[model samples]
Target chain A: MKVSSVVWLTLVWVLLWGTFTPLTLVGGVVVAVLVLWVARQAPSTDRLPVRPLRLLALVGYLVYDLLVSGAEVSWQVLRHGPRACGAIISVPLLTSSERVVTLMASALSLAPGAMALEIDHDAGVWYVYALGPRGASDVERTWLRTMDVQRRVLATFGTPEELARVRRLIEERVA
Target chain B: MITDVVSAVLMLAGALSCLLGALGLVRLPSLLSRLQAATKPQTLGLFLVLAGTALRVDLKSAATLLLVGLFQVITAPVISQIVGRSVHRSGGVRPEVLVVDELAEERPQDRPS
Candidate 1:
């Protein structure tokens, strides 16, 4: 089990119990280990490569995006009433990695007006469902915004080859 | 005293956002659009409420609430994605509201005839 996941669980355990004794800390560790062990009983998936600095950058962008998107959607929801010009757009996936696909899926879902409705990692494509008060002109723009997110995800965790392909794809698609 | 005021304001803001998210959920025309509203602002509301709670609590309890907030941020999107995929595959979306369906065109096999 990854030490970080275990430590995180223990921290959560400690906080939930609202106690800070050595015995409780030790007990938290035991419980965390047990939880990890149970999680391991399932089929193992490929390990995702996480570069801390890049992840920190992603987190920073997500925070900013969440605030902007939340406020934007909230405004649209209040003014336009949720039916305003929404579509499910198909986004081309540049990377072949399942982990990378998963990364982009979660990140895109949280980033403002777009939520990933379907992901077909094998076919190198996914569908994003976009919602907002955007008019018809903005449909292309919304799809392009979702592509921009793919670029960021590739930059953060993708291999050099994958990133290069993404760059090429961006030039072809975005430009 | 100042901390108390800050906590109260933050909590109120969180509650307002949460309320807005719920309203969006009810008001959205379709399932896909509703998922967007259910996840984004609701996630923010959660973070704000947790922060407000952490600020008002003792040190250890504060740490606990902050940890909970962090986990919520990490997991909320994944859950949203799961729900979205299930809905999409099940044809839960209203076909009329969709102005574009590029995925359908690309995969004719999956396209509904």
Candidate 2:
């Protein structure tokens, strides 16, 4: 585990304890180290190359999407009654990085109407359950929106080579 | 006074969001849509409530509230995903209501015999 990961875990530990005394801090550090040592490493164990600016942008977009979709879903629930139309669409992603796809899945789910049901990493596809899209056109739009979400996630967390590869795939209509 | 008013508004909105979520539970069409209604607005509601509380509380308590919000944001989606996957696999999702179900053919059981 990286030192940064250890520090972050310790911070979370202290926060969970709701105290910041020296003893708590020391205990948190020790526990964090021990947990990291015992825990199996995450599937994609490479250090995440996070671009702060892009990450901020991605976060801002997610928050905006979340609020807007929340309101939309709320309105749908109140207005649509039992006749609500939904769809399940598959979006092909450019990158197959497990970590980035997982992040994208979480973000998509948090956006309210669009919930990621399954991620086929080998095929680089996400099967998303979307609420309240009506016709074929609406489903197509949802698919495109999901692709955009994947692009933003890739931009934020992916390495430069991954980003370039995605761009190339987009250009080739492969993604 | 302004801060207090802002906090009150935030809390009220949060409560309203939660109410919508509960209402959706009773009114939504299926398990998946209900899951959407259950998790998303409730998540937004919780965060809004936490924001309101953070404004009223001291720094330490506010930090704890921030932690609560972070964990909710992290965990809610995961819970939703697990439930949704299970629902899909178990034939809980009604295909008649869906306009397009790309995942329907992905599972052998879901395919037409």
Candidate 3:
């Protein structure tokens, strides 16, 4: 059992209860243990190779994107009514890492204008639902934007080898 | 005084975001688009409200509010993903609204009845 998982789950339990009583703490530990024991799988032992500066950059971009997209969507709602254009463009995945994919999808979903509808990690593609990408050029732009999101995610959390792999993949695509 | 003013601004902005989210829910044509409104703006609104509340509260309670925001951020996307997937699978979206549907084209066999 990963101590960190136990500790994190227990913290969640305590927070949910909104109490730090001894009984609450004990109950949290017991519940965490039971959950972990029941759902026993190969724990991911790899420590995340987080690049702090890159992670900060990713976060900053997400926040800005969120605000801008939110305003854009809101304006669209008021001005355009129900006639807004929606598109589902599949973007090729750069890295096949599950964690990176999950993070990228979540970040994309959290921003207002785009949401990932389906992720085929095995196929190395994400089917993303985007607002306002209408024509062939717009779809291509949206595809590149999704790839950019994936690139930021890879840079922030990927190992050095994985980062190099992504760079190579991009270069190959360009070539 | 400055803190109060800032907090009020944050809270008001949060409220406006929530209103817009609700408006989108009613105005948007499709389920996926509605889900976009339901999840995204509401999330930002909640976060802003939590931030404003954290600023006004004592340190300990502020920590709790921060946890609330953290949990919301972590879980919101998961919820949206599940719902979005279901909608996509069930063909809840109108074809006219979608300019490009690569998912349907890419995996024709996976289409739901």
Candidate 4:
């Protein structure tokens, strides 16, 4: 039984009950155990070992990202107005963990100007339907920023070995 | 006094972000892009607004607000996913604008239509 799953199940159980009373707490334990049992029965996939400090840094980065990108996108939209200049770009991800991929995908989607459309889990690729063209203007910029979001997410949840592999992969791509 | 001022600031910030999102929706090109515009600011904006509300309210309500934020975080992406998939398959996007159409490749049957 994963401790985090137990804790998360209990949290949800409490949230559903809409209380933290002794009665609710007792009920949560029962619900959580049942939920955990079901989860155990389900085919378990991989989970990323998230780093506490790294996760904190990721949150800090997202706050900064949200503020900056909010302003940038607002300016772009207001200035340029709507145009049929968007692109569907496939970004290759290095991390094999589904949790990491999903985390990065959602985080990418959470940022302004990037919407993740699909995840090719076997290929470790994410099809990002983002804001602008390749390098002509706004779409390219959005693509880079979206990729940056993924890089930051990978840093947050990746183990040391995984992180090193990503570093090398990025370097190879850059080279 | 300081706490009140801080809460007010947070609220103002949230309102500004929500405004930005609305503006993006109005100004951005496509349905997908517009949906993209609606997401971050809306989520973060609402989260901030809820945080401000929590600050103003008592402890019990604050807990409720926290739970609300958690649920919002969990569900918002799912909503976006459904919306994106529907729009893509239904040809809500301007086909010319899509630089790459891999989905068309995956579902070859979808191409001619």
Give one digit per residue, the lDDT tens place, for model 3 in A27-146.
999999999999998866555775789889999999988898788778767877599788998777766567777888888876658888898878877789987666888787777777
Q: Tell me, by lDDT, which candidate is best.
A: 2
Evaluation by TM-score, superior candidate among 2 and 4: 2
Candidate 1, B23-48: lDDT as tens digits: 88888788777777888888888888
Clashes of 3: 0
User: Model 3 in CAPRI terms: which quality?
Assistant: medium
The C-alpha stretches of model 1 lying farther than 4 A from their native spots are A2-4, A41-50, A133-136, B107-113
True contacts kept of each: 0.74, 0.86, 0.70, 0.50
lDDT winner between candidates 2 and 4: 2
Ranking by DockQ: 2, 3, 1, 4
Off by over 4 Å in 3: A17-24, A45-47, A165-175, B109-113
What would the TM-score be for candidate 1 when compared with the true structure?
0.87
Query: Which residue pairs in candidate 4 collide?
Result: A132-A139, A133-A139
**By the DockQ metric, which is better: model 1 or model 4?**
1
Candidate 4 vs. true structure, TM-score: 0.83
Tens digit per residue, CA lDDT, model 1, A49-127: 6788887888899889988888877886898784555777777888777777877888887787788777777877788
Residue-level error in angstroms, candidate 3, position A36: 2.1
Candidate 2 residue-wise lDDT at A23: 89
The candidate maximizing DockQ is 2
Q: Which of 1 and 2 is ahead in lDDT?
A: 2
TM-score of each: 0.87, 0.92, 0.90, 0.83
DockQ of each: 0.64, 0.85, 0.70, 0.53
RMSD of 1: 2.6
